[model samples]
Target: MTNIHAPEVLISEVGPRDGLQSVKATMPTADKLRWIDALAAAGLREIEVASFVPAQLLPQMADAAQVVQHALRHTGVRVMALVPNLRGAQAALQAGAQKLTLPVSASPAHSMANVRKTPEAMVEEVKAVLRLRDEMAPGVPVEVGMSTAFGCTLQGLVPEDDVLRLAVLLAEAGVDEIGLSDTTGMGNPAQVSRLFKRMFQEIGPLTGAAHLHNTRGLGLANGLAAYEAGVRTFDSSLGGLGGCPYAPGASGNVVTEDLVVMFEAMGVSTGVDLHKLMAARAPLKAGLPGEPLYGMTPEAGLPKGWV
Candidate 1:
């Protein structure tokens, strides 16, 4: 058997959900579908189309079911959605989401403040969702994203032990995959490496993706750090929407354009066509007029035929 480098990284676009959720304007369902179509055409294999929660809470995703249905029409593309609890998971499954992701806070305080539940409570919630999937979804995969794993505004310093412990609990709860998220964007390269290395040691193959924020301008660096530590999947938002409201002026997740450029420039294939990716931005912009878009690669213009 020959050793195969994982080829290219997987860029999971979260713009429709994370990006749109942060903005005041609700992107029209038709425009959202057009954007998703453009993104799929651009070679993004997975896209978080929406979050299944109370529309009163997040009016932006009030049409999550419609968006998920639209995404599912594109064969071969993984349609994912965010669920805060069993209710959202059930809705997403009914909407035909191939994967459902739940945000499990590592900090107890953040968990309570964000989801109104403790970490352990959230773990149980995940278990319940997993059970629902086994009985309902059957083939659908349930993933838990450990948010604020790096640090939190509500809680000053999050302990690594707590993060790892929650990872174990979530795993035992029967989640198919566990993802780490820098919700607060306080993550640095060193911290990222150490945490991921430790996580892999304990959870090993159970680790999934790194959901990073460009809040402090270290999103790409932290992503690289995680990738070097054997992480292949990455979560990013198109045009860097949905910045941490806690951290003003910071971009949401790592910019999809910048992440693709970083990987493709290094001869690592992302399977994402930069030209097509950039072209997809037009529809995204059209969908959310007046919303600020962020990306270095887009501004710098792809370095003269560097595909």
Candidate 2:
């Protein structure tokens, strides 16, 4: 397992990247840093702080390097960034990001549309990025969130065998870990559990985080399925800020506040303080005025007399 995952469960906050990218507005760097600070203070250990994409493509993440620099100040936070290719990886590493995530789609239709490459081609890209990682940032870990592993809106009903095969390919390519993503949010709990079990059988401990979206109102349920399937790390957005710009009908990521509350309530020990986590939403609201945020726990507040 990557040293980035600690405690019984590690919540990797992806709001700054996945959450912000899907939104229509570009939040200023100052407010972005404040939102990250609020997340860290709320005890999020790994925060996906930026996506190293071209400014024209994603102006919201135009200051990705600057954001990474700011997030690094938090003592215990493992600051992460997303990279689309070798160039993005270089930029993220140069910015001192402690961990990196790359999306490798299991569906060919999704792959070509999202990254302009096929599945096999992306593996080669992963190799290229690994070579660069070895050359530039030897110890920094690289993760691949294989998007559309469960299903795809463009292609429909991805084969579980294909997902497993690509995961094995990624593990053999020497990535630190490989995570499954319900990119289009079409996954059911049963499919989630079954596929993750097979992934474990194939890649062993190299299996990584679960990146489930709440598009069908199954994000938390899918997350529970992953945990029961032996996944310990999860990617979520604060206040459910996420959706794929490339995937039609893709929606918000599993909300960090709600996921933490679910796990903590089940005695799973996510290590996040619920009160502080709820308070962290303030910066998000402040950063992008009038942007709708989602979290049932935050909206309802903690239960009465239930510390």
Candidate 3:
């Protein structure tokens, strides 16, 4: 078996932040930490542990600082936090977050609805967050995903040109990396490949992870499409936790266990253990008992003679 130190693909687990935020119940702090440890033990090098939003907006992440502090204890995993604006970024940096991801929605309506700011204003906010990171936590990478990149429930059929333009704008704003997000779970495989390709063309070295959801049940297919398009990093959740909270009909994120299986089966090293990854689901279920978990691989088990 190849070592995880340099896997062919990077699985960035977003269950803690993305998954937890969308759910109604707030997971206990200890349970959250245990889950993070479980994920790290399963070989996920990066984990979006918490979102630094106002407690009023997301009660589930009310303990963002605590979660970030605990997650940082894992020396191997890159502890990431999502911040909607400069204030949230400040809180995340103060809590010792290793990486920062901001959602800059492409749809004007989504931009306003999610963050109470226009798309252009969100870019300015990214610049502010970038400046703060430079002054306080220099070298802590900042990644921004163009949410609603494929389409939006508020605004149907987002123009491809608009998404590409936002990617370039974010790159120019000095964000360390730019990612395309299928926030609405409306993205198809063909669109996923083409948009990410164009994102690479525009941002080049800064093109980052593929943040796709399974609201429409195409998460794995879209992930494969992104991989073939040259995207190496993917954002997934343990049980495909709470889908895009901002999107009305969006369901869950790409399932991490299933995704690792898909990649490893294709001879692509995801650096995650299929056995341990599935086992990690215990803590997740314990944390959110009634919450529905989604993933085909976890339910079906590994195939006979699966590598």
TM-score of each: 0.96, 0.96, 0.96
Q: After superposition, how far is residue 12 of candidate 2 from its true place, in Å?
A: 0.6
Model 1 stretches with alpha carbons more than 4 Å out: 1-7
lDDT of each: 0.89, 0.91, 0.89
Please give the lDDT score at residue 135 for candidate 2: 94
Q: Model 1, residue 299: displacement in angstroms?
A: 0.7
For candidate 2, what is the TM-score?
A: 0.96
Error of 3 at 283 (Å): 0.7
User: Candidate 3 lDDT, tens digit per residue, 173-200?
Assistant: 8999888899888999999999889888
Among all candidates shown, the one with the greatest lDDT? 2
Show model 3 residue runs off by greater than 4 Å.
Answer: 1-5, 244-250
Higher-lDDT candidate among 2 and 3?
2
Model 1 residue 202 distance off true place after TM-score fit, in angstroms: 0.5
